[model samples]
Target: MREIDTTRVLCSLAELEVTGGRGFAVGEGDWPLRGFVVKTASGVAAYVNLCPHAGHPLNFRPHRFLTSDGNLILCHSHGALFARDSGLCIAGPCAGQSLTAVAIEVVAGYVLLGADVDVERLANDPL
Candidate 1:
């Protein structure tokens, strides 16, 4: 089995099966790197929790980032719909904008933040 890195683990693959997505945070204090991971058709994708339309966290409820049908990422604040894989805003006020992608990979049945990502930088300058 591959050695697991507990520090970087966001959520288990099994956990995503229930909700289709999961929110996570990295770092500490004032502003940790808040993000979410979603299961995509191709594999999985991660993005900053901040929505481009109103700069609000996409979900109003915990881990509820998908539409009712589990098709796209829904911004609860303003009804923005984004592509699950690419984070592109396909509908709503911010049509041409996209969510800030976070680097992540699944290994040993767990999702982990990519090694090169700077948590502090991302949390501070989410755009």
Candidate 2:
């Protein structure tokens, strides 16, 4: 399991001021990856930085993933609108395609991602 150094606690889940705002970028998994953890009044959501449109990072500018209204996750490369709740582009070039979600759990305001995610094992394993 990859160790997470979350000393820079951005904000507590209860202290999230806005909906669909950006969170910390903790390293996870086997490969080098940067994940954006989104926050809302209801709960939190996490997604890989990769965009489904053209295999590019979603955030063009630093810590600016959502639109001005803060309703959807916007791909700056092509202006794709992804729902914050579902992470699916409801309208855009990559419509119907959803962002790959990484499971996360909020513990005492710190978010912990699934570092040792066995993707291949899960795929090969039958229900």
Candidate 3:
């Protein structure tokens, strides 16, 4: 695995699920920026863990963010399925809605938070 600058690193791209998903957290204190990263054909995509339909964390099990077949993002809370690359909810209570995407970049085989993002603010915002 490649060593990344920890201040911005989320995970090593190699550690991310190739046909599934992996959960991650950034910052500190009560409201760290919780999210997940999914491996996609074009590269990687990430989103806030909060589900749009219920404002709940999408996974009930750790790092279990993708559907069994590994084609979509699954919210274990209520079966909401989202497109892996776009984070758009295609079915379920929040149909036509979308997951809140966290800006991420792949660098030196590491997934990282975009430099311009405010971690504390994004972590605390209810939206």
Candidate 4:
């Protein structure tokens, strides 16, 4: 089995407090895995930046992924709202669909991508 790299750090835990969420990228070359992390009631959560509704990136503005109330994930493209912890689309165009989740963990006050995640494959085929 190939070794999974768990050392990919996304951002510091303190950073999520300022904006509620933040975006990140992993891997190299042309197609890197793009994702975001959000602060949730239980802890922290992360997801692929792609919107299931139109296959567009969820955020147009840097680190801006939440709604005005800071209660949900907002897709800037079509106003789709998603649950922070579950990545479930609760409203808008893709009501029944969901954002692809990227596994993550918090360590030493930093958020890191999960070791089991296949960053390259998930980036290219985020279904």
Best by TM-score: 1
The candidate with the higher lDDT, 1 or 4, is 1
Runs of candidate 1 with Cα error greater than 4 angstroms are none
Write the residue-wise lDDT of candidate 1 on 1-127 in tens digits. 8888899999999999988999998999978999999999998999999999889999988899999999999999999999999999999999989999999988988999998999999999998
Model 4 spans with C-alpha error above 4 angstroms:
1-6
Whole-model lDDT, model 4: 0.90
Residues 11-117 of candidate 4 have per-residue lDDT tens digits of 99999988899999898997788999999999999999899998899888899999989999999999999999899999999998988989887887889898799
Q: Give the clashing pairs for model 4.
A: none
- TM-score order, best first, reads 1, 4, 3, 2
lDDT agreement with native, every candidate:
0.95, 0.67, 0.86, 0.90
Shift in Å, residue 97, candidate 3:
0.8
- The backbone clash count of each candidate, in order, is 0, 0, 0, 0
Per-model TM-score, in order, reads 0.98, 0.72, 0.92, 0.93
Which prediction has more favorable lDDT, 1 or 3? 1
Model 2, residue 11: C-alpha shift (Å): 6.8
Q: For candidate 3, give the lDDT of residue 61.
A: 84
For model 3, the run of ten residues with the poorest summed lDDT:
13-22
Give one digit per residue, the lDDT tens place, for model 2 in 1-127.
5444475344456545544556445434654445577764468777777778887778867667898888788988898989877788998899999887767666666666654644444323311
